[model samples]
Target: MSTEPIDGAALLDEVEAFHRRFNVFPTEAAYVAVTLWDAHAHLLDCFDSTPRLAFLSPEPGSGKTRALEIVEILVPQPMMAVNASAAALFRAASGAEGRPTILFDEIDTVFGPKAGDNEELRGFLNAGHRRSGVTYRCVGDGATQNVVAFPSYCAVAMGGLGHLPDTILTRSVIIRMRRRARNEKVEPFRARVHEKQGHALRDRLARWTEAARPLVDGVFPEMPEGVTDRPADVWEPLIAVADAAGGAWPARARAACLELVNASKTDDKGSIGIRLLTDLRDHVLNGIDRLPTVAILERLHSLDEAPWADMGGKPLDARGLSKLLRQYVTADNEPVAARNIKTGGGVLKGYYAADLSDAWARYCPPPPESPLLPLPPLPASSQP
Candidate 1:
């Protein structure tokens, strides 16, 4: 860990070296995942966004917690905690100058089913993916009690067994950890020895990031061919880091971005938003000029064994339906806002079929091709 002038590739290499000391990241994607997190941790101020590093494992002894402990030492201004409440995390992130890197270990204990719903924390994590995130909280007492907005932008690294809420996962760069095979071995992480290395590496990374700012600050580095939307957002910083590195790192970074981002997509379950869009296209949008919001809700609720039938123990309503589908189309207003449409019904409002078509084309899967039927009996009498 030298303070002398260093290139981005060398600095990233050092980070990877430090990570490998305590953990055996099962795949190249896994190794790149941690390296990018360490790189992003140091350059948080330079980028508009950063993705949370979610280290999840199927069970304990998967090196998930061990990885977090190591990460706790590498990031700049890390707020490392074995057990921190949502309030503590919010305050820690909001009150910090550069917004601390949150290294939360055993996260499932605080976020799992037994821990009950933590929508606020979930929302907080989700919001932080963008630089514009803010969380409002009521503070003080009596007349002093007024809601204040807190800056929610911060880099988070979390480790746990099993999956987090889908909302949190969507904004994260996930590293699925696993137990090391008998043949694979790593130096046991001793706090005394490892912490010093971690600190030195952090210092080196900090110095390099300061020097490399010009190459990356506010620059939109080119993305891989298929990377777009949220996946593109998640990888922007890493790709920038790779470009700044100026070597084979750029190619490696894109490969890892494509491999891991594609791997994160769930095969068994379809995306909820896409599924909703398909349902609307098939059953609701029938070239009508407009449909009352009430009619849409009724149709959605009529579907058997669907979440809309009894969403949250209450039938899905217009407002709820709007919220789910809102991300696809324009807001209540806008030309492509890119999908807002007319709504009306005396005191109630409706939606235009034209507005929904754009969302259908973008979000819905293609309908299956109709099978051709054999021509009817070839006019049997004519053949005779």
Candidate 2:
């Protein structure tokens, strides 16, 4: 290493510039988030948790794999894998050489429906977020068998089609990739020429991280409004790195944090129960105070392109709806169960609008604000 001083902020600028040269990220925030994530990996020992970097999209050729390839050249001891098993990952993560920066491509193959169950790998991904996280396994044979705890903590990045499990998704800085448009352009990544450049930047990042680690180790940078809990934990290290760098990065980091976090909120597909609640608020309720069970079912079944129309080859029945909603509570903290509602001739089993309020408020996005229309022109005679 050189004995000269390093300018942390300028070094980060170079890293960000390098990414822009090869990758057309979805937004400016994606660039900032990925840059900070690269720097944070070098300072992993300074923080209690490291957020997983996830690049996901609905289709192929959207640069998901390219994003991981870029990350591979920037981080320390990069271990790139595809279709790797849990046993293999565990061995790699616990290798004596130190925790490798695990970059997984085609991660959907490990967690997607066609791949079947991978509980061990899922558990590893979840536990690895925190410093103290570990997994136990039986070692040795028969008489000599002993349960040993293996360290699961490591910096992880993944690229794949579609979504990850909710456990992993919540702990990640997700970049939703999209195919480049006709006019959009980026340099074709040629490893022969670019690998050396990326490696050079990687070296500078490592040097800067060593010098700045002491300053950022325990620093608690302020979070933007509405950023708290798991999102706060996921962003803490990245923001801390930006703070140490100084210059425009501090403001840029916070802005990116808020933007990405809020975007995740909007993009969240949510559970089926939550989806039902949102549909009820947007469709069936329509300002009515109450609705009969049969009436609600009719409206739900009539929705085109909705799962309710052909759920397991049948329309959503009252039993299924009840089962889904029963897990939630009402405004009064009572079970959201159907009760007797009086009709002209007799009573019918139905739901009160009041009972669904709590679930709707908690699970659904706020209604969109109507665009303010300009007031009609004042009458010619009335104009002063």
Candidate 3:
């Protein structure tokens, strides 16, 4: 292994060559290879200090695990594979001389809808990413043991499960994997045959990483725009890695950040949020103009499978529906309010046509009514 500093441009070329030789799908392989290259470079500097994580999530039969296996060969330090107790993980991470890369297969099994199994994993992963090492009590021979601290800076690669725990997801660079089509074929990866080539590429990458260390450490780039909430945290290091590389990486980093993070944000699992409710309310206002309490309730009930069906703690009954509408309507403009100006019952108990006018214009614009639209006729043979 050459101890000389790496040429970034040359390193990239080596990566491309190695990828073409063994990598099956260029698109998926390119993404994973670039990410690994970037991450490995970043880890060289302050390898003991910085904590980082990458997630490889692909559809079933996608080569995510195989990609990680390739990654293990490239990174300098020995990587441990684990699917066990959080304590054992922390212990191993703490004992490593430098930040050890931990490859977690099927991380979602520990964090997905299984409930209790996810909590400890979540806690440990969260703690491991912090700048300061985490401290926990160890059980010793007798009485309570003293507090033991574990290094927080380590690189983690997780595969299996598309959705990760929100905490880990926020702190990881996500690589989406696609299944191989029938036509595309790659040579079987043999460790002995490819080992030398992989090592050469890794050595070059390591040297370049050393050269770029100063830049990575000095410039901690801000999170890309449009990456809010949990995903922002996850991509931060990856973005930082890209920033260190310079050239077109800065722009590419931001673009990838926006694409992946924004995609996750747009995944609406039928949850009730302001946008959904606003749309639903606008739909009702445009169709019926002003509706009575029962009419509104019927409309809300009709939308049982919609977002507003179970909004505000119940299945939007008359009272609950009226309460929600009252927030937007005014007494003077309502029909009931106009008829019984003195009585409290007649006061705008629900939404009025004028109250929804603005919302209608904004959310559900009026479409021109069809004139003499013809209906579909029965089959010609049947009609005859």
Candidate 4:
């Protein structure tokens, strides 16, 4: 291993070289390569005693499997590729060297609906991320085989479609792959030649790892603010790896966390659910707040006039609006007193903005009156 430090620019150069040699798109491949390097770096430091998991997912024909093949060659240590089984996996992992990186391909097949056939494997995958190991007895001949326990420290690289099981996803760094553009070209990966190049890169990475490993062992950086939920735990080490790399990676890691890690809450369908809630809250604050179910229906209908109408589908109707609101607000089956109207008609129910103060504060905070609009004269009876 070389004694020189592995800088970000050098890392990028290596990644670009690998991408060209392997015939993978730069945007998708570069990011994955850097992240893998970072993950490996971190494993050497923080989890020198454990294993880590990386999942590469993209739509069909996006080259996830090929990327894994490249990683298998580049990551240092005694690496093996196989479909992980509960017993075999525990056995392999139990004796893995420090900071092991495990690459699993077609993980969806292993954990999808058909995963039921291998419940023990699924359980192992789930428990593998934690700092604890699992134990089970072997049912053998005369005397039951002694129960065996295995260590759960290993870095994983899994590739497949859409998403992984939540259990695994919550603990893995996800790399999204994208299809190569028609205009882009990559050199063919000639095994005889590329294998040598791949080995060279691995040697460089191993050297970098040996130098940086001591700095990261069992130490993790604090997570950035505004990051929440399971992704925080899964990515903490990856970010630390970036930090350990020192230049550019710190920023890149934070950006990746914000971009990919926090992607779960975003919806591509439409803005109707949150927007309708905002409009309701607006109406409430204006004191025109309470409207009969009919009035609410009318306002929704009016949204068809311009901008809102073009948002998605038709403007929400009472039933459609109610169903959508059910996700974030509560309602009752019996008639309830409305702000400005009395109930007793055919309408048996209605909803109020559950909490306008907070929702409005976030979605539609009060804006200062436009100076450009002409102000109405003071009430006729009173002169300014």
Q: Per-residue lDDT of 1-384 in model 4, one digit per residue for the tens?
A: 345567744664475467556546434434643444534633543552232444454567787777777777676554455666767666666764553566777777776645534667667777666665554546456686665566655556667766565556556555566677887666766778787887777776666666666766676666778775466666666666666677666676677667665453341112445556555654333456355666776666575333344334575556665566555423333322333445666443455553334444444424435558788889978985
Error of 4 at 217 (Å): 2.2
Q: Which model scores highest in TM-score?
A: 2
For residues 158-274, write the lDDT of model 3, one tens digit per residue.
776667755565565556666767876767899897877787767666767776777666455687665654555455555666666665565666776676665544442212323
| Backbone clash count, each prediction separately | 4, 0, 4, 12
Q: CA shift at 237, candidate 1, in angstroms?
A: 0.8
For every candidate, C-alpha RMSD to the true structure in Å: 7.9, 3.3, 10.2, 8.3
Ranking by TM-score: 2, 1, 3, 4
Candidate number of the best lDDT: 2
Candidate 2 per-residue lDDT over residues 1-384, each given as its tens digit = 587978999999999998998898999999999999999999988999999999999999999888998999999999999988777887788889998999999999988867766899999988889988887889999999999988988999999988888889999999999999998889989999999999999999999999998989988889888899999999999999999999999999999999999999888756778778877887888689888899999999988756787876898999998998899899889889988989886898888878999988887878656668889999999999
Candidate with the larger TM-score of 1 and 3: 1
TM-score of each: 0.73, 0.89, 0.65, 0.63
Model 2 residue runs over 4 Å out of place are: 142-145, 302-306, 310-315, 331-333, 344-348, 370-384
Model 1, C-alpha of 353: deviation from truth (Å): 17
True lDDT of residue 4, candidate 1:
61
